[model samples]
Target: MPQMFRHRGFTGRIRRNYPMKKILKWTGIGVLAFAIVIIAALLIIPMFVDIQDYKPRLETMVSEKTGRDFAIGGDLELSLFPWAGISFSDLRLGNPPGYREKIFLSIESFDVRVKLLPLISKDIQVKRFVIEGPHLVLEKSSDGKGNWEEFGERREPEKKTATETQQEPRADMLPVKTLQVEECAIKNGTVAWIDDAAGTRNTLSELNLDLQNVSLDKPVDISLSANLDGRPLSMKGFLGPVGEKPGTGPLAFDLALSALDQLNLTVKGKVTDAATAPRFDAAFDLSPFSPRKLLDSFSVPFPVKTADPGVLNKIAAKGSITGSTEKISVNNGRLNMDDSAISFTVDAGEFQKPVLSFNMEVDSIDLDRYMPPPAEEAEAASKPKKKPDPEAGIDYGPLRKPVINGTVQIKNLTFSEARVSDLSIKISAKGGRYNIEPIELAAYEGTLKAGAILNVQKDTPSASAELNIMGMKINPLLQDVIDKDFLDGTLKAQMSIAFTGDEPNAIKKTLGGSGELLFEDGAVVGIDMAGMVRNVTASFGLSDKPGEKPRTDFSELIAPFTIKNGVVNTSGTTMKSPLLRLVVTGNANLVTETLDMRVEPKVVGTLKGQGDTKERSGLAVPILISGTFSEPKFKPDLKGIVTQGLKLPKTEDLKKALPGGDEIQKESLKDSAKDLLKGLPLKKK
Candidate 1:
């Protein structure tokens, strides 16, 4: 039996392996038959199938799921193998009409894989893709009844896996498990980020992203780069669920990103709990942050003055913040900007904190180069009409810069400065409002203490402070203030001002605070009160003392005056010759720069009983001033007499009798003075 079976080649010795020719011929036939079936399916089946209906069916399914009207124009074609994909050419989609909704999405060329099986089997695969060249458009109406995000509440995620049917995951499908994605790439991608809430639209160009080896059981690695607003930024990161758990899985990540020429940032973060409530901690390091450059990148204009151009080049910052569901804390924070440094630590427990502190220090700043121009000067310069002249008109106020350097003490803060440009301040406050204490500063010396309440909500501030002067010189400050029109006196007064205001003009108007103004041995500049009094007396027929020569110097004109609470009171001092005694008291409203005063003049130290001999013993002058500041109406009238009451020398008679009238009148005028004084005993000598 075995020999018979072997002769038929059904057993034993394999019958010397069938003839190679016959074996190969059958294999070729079988392969040819398989190829024929495949070609028929590829070339003929798609032609017969109604692919147009698939478009509406897809549209209906989308509409049903999203509760939005969906429509598509044109037929869809699905190819079978070898170029295996779905194609939609000249396709247009929109939100259905007649529903106050407007949405339109169009595609010129699109193709997608018909099956995802190959991708799951570790092969390069894609499902449904689109390629549009410059003509694709998406539109949304202002009313917001449009596409993707406008869909109603999202469906709940499923918690199970799909069965062997190998269908697309439905809304009710199980939570994703063991998701795996192989290499994916994009080229020349462009996307627009639109924020309807903020009404902002930003476009990113030349965008590229590469994602590799993403897995739910493993870490995900990604790299992306894009050109944003003419700046290049690149980012790389790795992310994963922590501890290899699902509901309990946390997030762990490390990322590095930077904008070209502006800033570089690196961060590491982790979330410890994904269920109940999440707890997270993150540390960030930012380096080479240029304030000017960063602001410029965002199109913000900065008016900073730099000694060396582009000196504000770099800044570095490091900080870490940790927070649970209810509490948060920060530690190890430091910020460095050029030569400046700031550091702080803060911790909070559900908004309840007892101690918080901050400290800052600045190396140096130039005040004169950085401070803004005076308000009056800036305003005058901006006017197009006939602008007011700074010096010709009255400028009630002009700003003065003070030299500022030293440590500042805040509640829990201490800010130290090496030197500040163009700033001088004398500030003090009482009763929670700045009320200048009576003080005079010869020169602003060292550390100053500030008192003020800064109300950020109202965007208003009130401050008062006392600048402590250890030992300083005053000549320079006094000279500068005098030159700047703060006062019109050669007198040097050492004083400090305590004032509060949001503006320079306001502070100037209130430049008054009760501070002692000490005058050294300097004389009054351009003020000759004695000469004025002499003229008044001469015009009034008031006689000079017999032994004394006429007075010329103005040092004797003004008696010392003290200012307090807006009142000026002359000291009780008597002048020597002509025996004039001045008694003046009045209030000077500094805001208006007006003086309302009463001047009483009396004779003293006369040879004879001048007071009794003269018809008037005292001259009470009522002074009135009116007009714009620079040129004012300054008139002083004797209480009982007018200007006509004064006696005048006979100038016409002397002029007619003199050849050298201009010169002889001067000598004859003296002889006439001798004649006019003939009756006095001193004149006889």
Candidate 2:
């Protein structure tokens, strides 16, 4: 038994120890040697492989599939261990038939490196990927087809049935579990659009891009610089932490972009569910810059001629936008144009027939500044004027689709010679009809409340308005509108009008409405009753009449009118005062802008403190006004005054009525009244 034990030796003890440590050590050494050999073979074998020998086969294979010539003109190099990589230079893809250019795409150099071990598990860890001097040309063939079209097998892709399409899963997540990239760059790449038929060529060239620290779980820094049609453009940004599953989660981005060295924009945003239903919230800022200089840099003329040359010189905007596939909203929006600033908010959806709601407010705006100046009369007359082109009827089809609800407020607004403050307009539109409800403004020491409706459902669009103006100073209003005043009053008016068409002449001809205007304690300039009575006495020396001004005063005046078929008729216009009572009836043609009116003044009221008895009677001295609105001609009705005064019972009674005038003096008053009716003739005195 002792000898048997001695022979067995340490075998029993080795079994007891289990020998696991030695087995593991030898297994590790073997693995290390095997790995070293494999790595060495990978590093050294490629040195003699001469991958160029396969280039012809690759080219032929690609050309056969694409139906285009392909070639590699430079050596291909490969590296293994440290990083697995391939690099090549001077690769070209030939254009399709009927193109003048021989090559459609050409790459000067390309290189990519990745971790090989991770690729075995289908995960890519890119170390360096670079493309240099890669140029792509998009050319239109003589047949109007693009050179880049109809590539690969000339067969349409299989169309999936509804069931199959619904069952197929979209590739929102990459095949790899993770992606890590250290460096990625595209250097001096270019794309060109050439159309020989149109004699045009546009190129985006010198495109250099770099991406830093790109990973599925970490933000990537990106910088890009390029020239678009000879204009410089650059962008730098941070994007993503795209997560392990791209297009499945939110992506955050912040970027700054500059174009043409004139405009700079910054964007910060987050996007979610990008592959299916993308939703985004973003803030955008555009730094102040000169729009004129930017357009000039592009060699493009300004789009509109403006009265003020300094306008549109600087413009900027900032806003926040939130949107999904179904809806979009803009909030906290600010826009600056020259000296004007506006803030607004907007929400929109239903892109096919858009529905929109918005609120906009402007601190101040001068519409006249943006409008083209009127031509001087001399210049307009000297130019050989062409007959105006016939105006085309407006197309209301587009208006029928959009639904709008909005309000606009302007603190100060100026148009032409008029200036208004606190202008507020609430607007709504749907189905071809639009309403501006309760438009309110302040002007000329008065408040104007108005509303308008525009209906485009008819072939000829129609519009109507209702207006109320209260406590207005007509002198200032007239002075602002015409730069002169012929009358003074405190005006109160209510007006309603309906009109068809969109031109001044058309509106005037089609206008129909009713309105009433009241003037309190006002004067009708250029017509003086007292002056006319005194003129006859002074001429005949019946009595030396004191000098009187050429004016007619009234305590209260009312002019009520109705308009139809472009003619304005007023039968109820009357004036009352302590001295005289006046009645006026008139027809004014809006289309022709002419006036035919009659006025009768009576000095029948008992002239208190005039040394006269209460036996006052009604008398009439008629006047006629007939002329264009711009130049009215006025004359006294001499036949009624002169011949009627002769029929009086006595010249003494007539003299008492005429403020110390005899029968001859009364006849002279008739002649002088004619001279008094003309505003210009009496103004010289």
Candidate 3:
């Protein structure tokens, strides 16, 4: 019994010690085996697993996928410390057939380091990815085919063999649990675009892009810089976590762009989908700069040269835009140029051919300053050259585009010497035609309303307008429009005019219209109809006092006129006053600016407002007004006066002219003597 107890105690101790010894021995063996394998791999694996030997396979795979030839001129390199990295040098991608450029893409080198342990969990964790000296060319042929689109062609799938199909179904590749990129950089890159159809070649050089901490679940910060067409541009922003599909993520960006002139712009925006059809809300600020200088910097010619140099300078704008692929909206848009301010809003649809609806307001604008000086224009026009046809240079191509509907209001607008206030215009365009309806404005102490239609569908562009003017002061209007105040009155006028031409002279020459004018309590300055008539009748000749400025005051003047082929004809333009009544019948040639008019003046019985004058009746005088607009001449109608004089007989010769003249005269004398005696006696029966 004692011996059995001792053996049991020894067996219990042996059990505890044997368990610890077995664990220690196995642990040592595992350590030794792991070390040996690692050492063997580090020393021997590279010799057998040559990456260059796989270059042909890699090239073949890329060629099959892209339908283009791909080649690696330099060897492939691999590294194993810290992380597994693969690097390639001098890679070239060939362009498709019919392209002039052989190579579409070429890279000096590309390096990528990946965390090897993440593969066990089916996670793609990249420590760093770098690209250096990459040159990419994009070209579009004359037939509108682009080289970039060649790779997108669909290819038929390879059918599985019967043996492969009979094999057991392979286990599923594990889903990616995590995808992280510590850093990615592209440096010294160049992109060039060649468009044979447009005859344009543009290049972007010195392109550098960097991304830090790019991951599937965290925001990635990005910085980009490039020289575009010799202009430096920079961008920096953050993008939110990427989703399963491209462009399905939150994005924020800021960009700064500047040109050689004082042109600078800053843009800030947030995009919901950045890769595909992005929806973005963006705000932009443009610094005050000269448009002329900016255009010159881009080697673009400016069509207009303002008379005042400062007119086109100091242009700036601030606005916000929101849009998707199909539609866009602009809000709170403001443009400032010199002393003018304009605010507008626009909603547009159909990005390819936009149809726009807009509303805009302008505080004030002086368009005269932006126009060429009159003297300069005149000088240019006087040069010896063949005149171009009126319709030769009219380009109606823009009218074929999408339609626009809008309204524009201006508080004050000045063009040349004409000033308009409280102007509002409703405009619409469609089918190669534009209409400006309900154009209302206040001008010359009066209200004017008009509508105009321009049709570009016709071979020769044509325009028609209808205008109404009410209660306008004629003196100020004439002073501004013609630089002369020929009359003063409250005037009302209405007209409908149509012309078919593309040049100013042609339009005036082709004008055809009719209108009526009425003036109340006005005076016609620079000429006196009554005095001219009296002088011409008395002397039967033209007579004028030297240095005398005569004016005719009238209670009312009414003129109804018609125009045909640039000639204005008035049948009977009448002017009524206390002293005289005058009628004018004439035609004025607008093209030649010449007047051929006849004026007839009739004297009334007595002048109520003037000093007592003998009653003058049965006296009519005809005068002729014939001259250019700048220099007019007034003269008596000598031929008509001579004819009237010859038709009338003298009073002393009336007995011979009429048979009963002598007898009537004797009877009249006897009756007059009897009446005189009766009046002296003061007797009546």
lDDT of 3 by residue, 1-685 (tens): 8899999999999998998999999999999999778767855776678889889999999998898999999989887644778899999999999887889999999999997656777688898899999999999999999999959468799898999877844322225667888879999999999998888887899999999878767677878888877877666766655644435566666666664447688888778856656799999999899887767776777878777866786799999999988899999999998999999999999755569899999999988888997778878877776778644686777675768899999999988678999999999988779999989999888989999999898767888899898988888876776566568788888888888887767776989999888898898775555554443322221232347555678889999899888888999899997778988899988778777988777777677557767664444556676666655544445465577672332444323223244555444323321221222211211
Q: Output the number of the lDDT-best candidate.
A: 2
Q: What is the C-alpha RMSD of each candidate to the true structure, in Å?
A: 15.4, 7.5, 13.8
lDDT of 2 by residue, 233-258 (tens): 99999999998778989999999999
- Give the alpha carbon lDDT tens digit for every residue of 513-604 in model 1: 33333322233332223333434433222333334333322123333444443333444422333435555455454455544544444444
Query: Which has the greatest TM-score?
Result: 2
- Write down the lDDT of every candidate, Cα atoms only: 0.48, 0.81, 0.77
Q: Which portions of model 2 show Cα errors greater than 4 Å? A: 1-86, 91-105, 136-157, 161-167, 191-205, 227-232, 376-393, 502-506, 525-552, 577-579, 592-594, 603-621, 627-685
TM-score of each: 0.50, 0.77, 0.70
Q: How far off is residue 133 in model 1, in Å?
A: 9.5
- Model 1 scores what on Cα lDDT? 0.48
Arranged by lDDT, best first: 2, 3, 1
State how far residue 190 of model 2 sits from its true place (Å): 3.9
